[model samples]
Each structure stands twice: as C-alpha cells, then as structure tokens.
Target: MPTVNDVEWDLVGISEIRWMLGGLSRQRTNVIANTKGFPDPIAELEMGKVWLRRDVEAWIRDNRPELLENKKGPTPE
Candidate 1:
C-alpha cells in the first residue's frame, strides 16, 4: 500500500482554479467555488484557500466539459 509520503498531491489555489475554469472573473469564480456541488477546499491558508487539482478537474469534467477543449494555458492577467 502507498503511504501518504508516497502520494503526490497537485494542489491549486483560487487563481489556478480561475485559470482552470476558462479564466472566469474572480467574482464568478467565487460563486462557482461556493456552489453546493463544488468540492470542498482541502486547506485554507493566509494566501487563501487551496484545493486538490484533481477535485477541481473532476468538477470541471462534470460541470464544464466544454472548457476542457483547447485548454492550453491560463488567460493573461
């Protein structure tokens, strides 16, 4: 069995999630993040909340499959 140390967690923050969801506005991202079906954040720190990348991706897969197409990089700031 794999130990916790053996696992690699790909964590993400609000900005990263904003990028994942096709560069939604910060307000929109906050709305989506707080939606009932959205995954609960894995941790919260001084910088902000952080989530598991896979969880966010899974939510996208189920809720916003269209965004995945042509998903290459984050939108410019």
Candidate 2:
C-alpha cells in the first residue's frame, strides 16, 4: 500500500474534511456535503463518507475562494 506522503492521499473521511474546512459543525458539514457539485464520495465505509481532496478543493476554490485565503496549513501542491 502507498503511504500518505507517497501518494496525494487526497482521499479523506468526513471528519478530516471538516477539519480541513476549519472544523465546521456537523450540521454545517452535512449541509455542505449535500450541496450540489460537492463531489461524490470515493467510498462509503462504515466509519463515514470519503471524498477526494482535489475535488473538494476545486469546489471550495470555485464556490468559496475566500476560505482558502484564511486557511493555515500545508496546502497540497
């Protein structure tokens, strides 16, 4: 299996996605997840849903670029 750093490892679960989005509330996360063009999950595991970081990043960039401006983290290259 590939390591996180080896691969883009953009695939992430709901909680991780929430954290990436600055720790959004569960309700808000649900709302955002259901929004159109929010990117379909790569897999639906028992733990929760997963999404491609690239897809989510694209959505955020196209819909809410402002969020990126305030974010503080090592953004994917």
Q: Cα deviation in Å at residue 52, candidate 2?
A: 0.9
What would the per-residue lDDT of candidate 2 be over residues 1-77, giving only the tens digit for each residue? 44566657568777877876778987788788988878887678888888778878888888877788887566789
Clashing pairs in 1: none
Show where candidate 2 strays beyond 4 Å.
1-9, 72-77
Instruction: Report the lDDT tens digits of candidate 1 across residue range 6-77.
Output: 656798998999999888898899999999999998778999998888889999999998898667567779
The lDDT per prediction is: 0.87, 0.79
- At residue 70, candidate 1 shows an lDDT of 61
Model 2: lDDT to the true structure: 0.79
Error of 2 at 7 (Å): 9.0
